[model samples]
Every structure is written in C-alpha cells, then in structure tokens.
Target: MKRLFAFLFAALMLAPAVQAAEAPDVLIRRLSTEMIDRIRADEQLQSGNLARMSELVDSVLMPHVNFQRMTALAVGRNWRGASPEQQKQLMTEFRALLLRTYAGALASAKDQSVRMKPMRADPADKEVIVRSEVVQPRGGEPIQLDYRLEKAGDGWKVFDVNVLGVWLVQTYRSQFAQEVSANGIDGLIRSLVEKNRSAGAAGTR
Candidate 1:
C-alpha cells in the first residue's frame, strides 16, 4: 500500500495550475514531462528537501486536485454524518497527510518519466480517466497509474487515482470506515492528526 501511494505521488509529478482549455490527457502528459525534467535538473529536489517539495506541491499540485472530494470519498458513508466543521477538519488533516507523503515521494524521485496511454473520452464528458505508467530508472517494470478527473468550473480536478489496479479512495475507504466506526468522526480526525504530526516530526529529524 505504501509503495502504491509512492507510485501515485511520483506519477502526479509537479503540475502547475492548469488552464481550463487544456485537454485532460494533454495536461497529464505536459506536466509529467515537466516534472521529470525538473527533477532531473534540480539538485535540492533530487536530494529530497521536504520543505521545498511541500511548498512546490501546495502551489503546483493542490489547485489541480479536488482534495475535499477525495477526503469525502475516503471517509465513505461517514461523510454524510459528520458536521460541517468536522468535515472541514477531516479535509485539513487528510490533506496534510497526503501532502507529507507526497513531499517524501517527490524528494526520492529520480530518473523517472511518465508514459501516457491514449485516453478515450468524449469532448462533452464531465469526468474522465487518464491512463499512464511510470517508467522507472534502470529499466524497471513500468507501474500502471491512472487518474480520475472531473471537470470543474475552472478546469479539471483529479479526485482519485488507481495504482496497480487498486483505486486509492477504495483502499482508504475500508480503513477510514473502520476508524470512524471505532471512534466516531472526531476520533478519525484525531487519528489523521497524529499521523500527520508524526510524519512532520520524522521529516524534521
């Protein structure tokens, strides 16, 4: 699961705020290429500078993703039961967790490029799947990576990802559901808080 999450972070790369006019597949291909080039050229990023990577991710990647939707999906049915404030807290903590993990993945990225497969979606569709793979260094087996994106007013926002046939939202759904079941929404929030806190401490050390 951890490896798959890493694959997802690597596959997303560093995407700048996207233009609404760009096609989803085009967006993926362009950003994937850009990220590979940037990683290869930047010594600080290649060395795994967490702070720099985290800042880049916030500025470049967050705008392209629908993290609130992702948090709701991961929380499953419990999403409807939580108060608005709880939902907000959940989103905050969940975003922190993902951001921390993504920063770590970015720092470790080296000599990796993404290969995008042909996407089959109608021009009028509101949601689409963009398929791709990560070509690892030294001729390693390419890992299958896919994205689920929905058309927002500004542009397409990625909501979920699939790695090695396992959808990220589904993978976390069961675990999050268990957490919510055992301790309620606040409990789940506390769990995510502790996780992000631990990751933050570890990164600083």
Candidate 2:
C-alpha cells in the first residue's frame, strides 16, 4: 500500500490546464506522463528536495483537485460537527499532510508510469470514476488506481482516489472518525497539525 500511494503521487500530479474541456482520462494520462518525465530529468526532485517537490505538487497537482470536497468526505459525518473555523483549519492541516506525503514519496519516483484503464461514463454525467494502474519498472504487479471526479464549470475536478483496492477518502474517514469520537473536531485538527509538524521535521533531516 505504501508503494501504491507512492505511485499515486506521480500519477496525480496533473499539470496546469491547457484545455478546460479535456477528457478526464486524457487529462490524467497526459499530465501524469509529463510529470513522470519531469521527475526523471530533475536532479533536485530526484535528490529528495521536499521544498521543490512540494511546490511542484502544490502548483501543478492541486489545481485539478476538489480538495474541499475531499476533506469533507474524509471527515464524514463529523464534518457537519465542525464549525466554519474548524472546517477551515481541518482543510489546511489535511492539505499540508497530503502535500508533505506526496512530496516525500515523489523523491523515490523512477521509471514509474501510469497506465490508464478504460473510463466508463456518460458524456452528460456530472461525476465519474476513471480507473488506472501503476506500471512498476521492476515488473512487479500493477497497482490499481482509480479517481472519482466531478464536473466543475468547464472542467473536471478530482475528489477521491482509490489505491490498491482501498479508497483514500474512506481510509482517512475511519481515522478521522476515531479521532473525532475520542477528542472532538478541534482535537482532530490538533492531531493533524501535530502529524504535519512531525512529518515536516523528519523531511528536513
């Protein structure tokens, strides 16, 4: 699962939008390929420069994601318990956690490529799931990766991801629910903050 998430960091690094109306599968495939090439050629990123990798993900990958929805979904029923301020804080901390994880994982990216599977959705559908897999360079089993996206304005925004048979939002939902149950919404925010802090410290060393 760790390796699967690592591959996800590469696959989800969608580039800046060149076409607002681009098909979801095409968008994912093109940008993932571009990112793989960029990572392979960039010495700083390959050398584990978290700052650079994080910046790259923030600038290029985040724009395509509907992070507010992702955060809300991950929080599950507990999301309604959060005040406006708490919700904002939760989003901030969760986004930081994801950014740091992706940045750290991307440092080891090499010869990893995304293989896009067939997308099944009506053209008029507002939401859809795009399936895919990570083709490892070492010829290991291909890891399953899927994306749930919603049509926003003139483009698509990813809200959830499935990696190695586990959905990202669902996995986090379980953890967030446990935290909220034990210590309330504010407690969850604090926990996320501490987690991000610990990860940031480890990255610097």
Candidate 3:
C-alpha cells in the first residue's frame, strides 16, 4: 500500500511537459493531464497489463526521474562502500523494484484527478518541492503528494516523493538499510529482484 501510494505520487506528480520553458509546477500539470488522458484511453492499462504499464513508465516517465539519486538515497550510507559493480547491481534492482511496484499501481489512476498548489521557487534555485492533491473518484478524500526535483542539465527531474507527509526515499532507505544489515547488500539485491519477479508473476496470474 505504501509503494502504491509512493508511485501514485510519482505517476501523478513527476511528469514533465518538455515542449518549452516552464516552471516545475506547469510541467507537472501539463504532463499529468496528458498522461492521465493516455491512461484513461489505454485498454491495456485499464485491464492492468503490467508489461504494458511498465513500458509506459519506461518510455514516458523514467526519463523525467532522477533514479541515480533515488538509488543512492535508498541505499543510505552504505552506498559509498559498494564497489562499482555492486552499485550498478543495486541501481538495476532498485529500478526494477520501482517499475514493477508502480506498474501495477498505475492502473489505479483511472478516474483520478489532480490539483496543484502554487509552485514556489526561485528561478535560480537548483531544486524545489512541488505539492499537489489527488482526488479519487466516488467522493474519496484527496491524497496529498509532493515531489522533490532538481535541475539537471536537461531540465528538472524528480528524485524523491512525499506522500501524506512521509518521504518516499526515506521510507525505502530505512527498509533497504535494515535488509542490507541483516543479510548484506547482495541479499538486498536478491530480495528486490524476488519482489519484482513476484509482482510480475502476480500480473500473469
């Protein structure tokens, strides 16, 4: 449920409209609208096809996210101690975990709408947080979501998410740290791989 909440925050908030110059809020608003419409129309997504949903996330959403930072933060202080190969492995597993977790959750976007608060940031600032609310259908209460983004060379990219006041990266960081401490870094990777595989298998069932 926490993973779904985190990804729902990402899917609804991290989208960037890359057509022209814009603030982070405008970019999010534009892409969220566009992607929400696309999700609504995609029969595969409506049917909860995880493969197709992952493809959508990879093609459309991954580019706008700062996965390197996310992976490092989730790995916590143990990251610098990891070898290059281990780092790569960690990133790969972390990426797979996110894609698999969020792919299934993406289907929940059906009939959801988002509203943004005023975006506050200096034009010269390199990073900022954007806040918004997701309105679920059938008169459900709105979910509070926030995105933390930094100005990469290409443009602003999301690195962490805050859902209902809890930070996404921080949440995963604690879990990753505990898992690595118990079984080791390689064990952490294996666990993530297994979780992703289970998600995939569940999708096929």
RMSD of 2: 1.6
Query: Which residue pairs in model 3 clash with each other?
Result: none
Find the 10 residues in a row with the least total lDDT in model 1. Answer: 2-11
Where is model 3 poorest over a 10-residue stretch in terms of lDDT? Answer: 6-15
Residues 19-121 of candidate 1 have per-residue lDDT tens digits of 9888989877877777777777888876667777667766776778888899999999999999999999998898778767766666445666788898999
Candidate 2, clashing residue pairs?
Answer: none
Weakest 10 consecutive residues of candidate 2 by summed lDDT: 9-18
Provide TM-scores for the models: 0.91, 0.93, 0.89
Shift in Å, residue 199, candidate 2: 1.3
- What's the lDDT for all of these models? 0.81, 0.80, 0.75
Better of 2 and 3 by lDDT: 2
Off by over 4 Å in 3: 2-20
**How many clashes would you count in candidate 2?**
0
lDDT for 141 in candidate 2 is 82
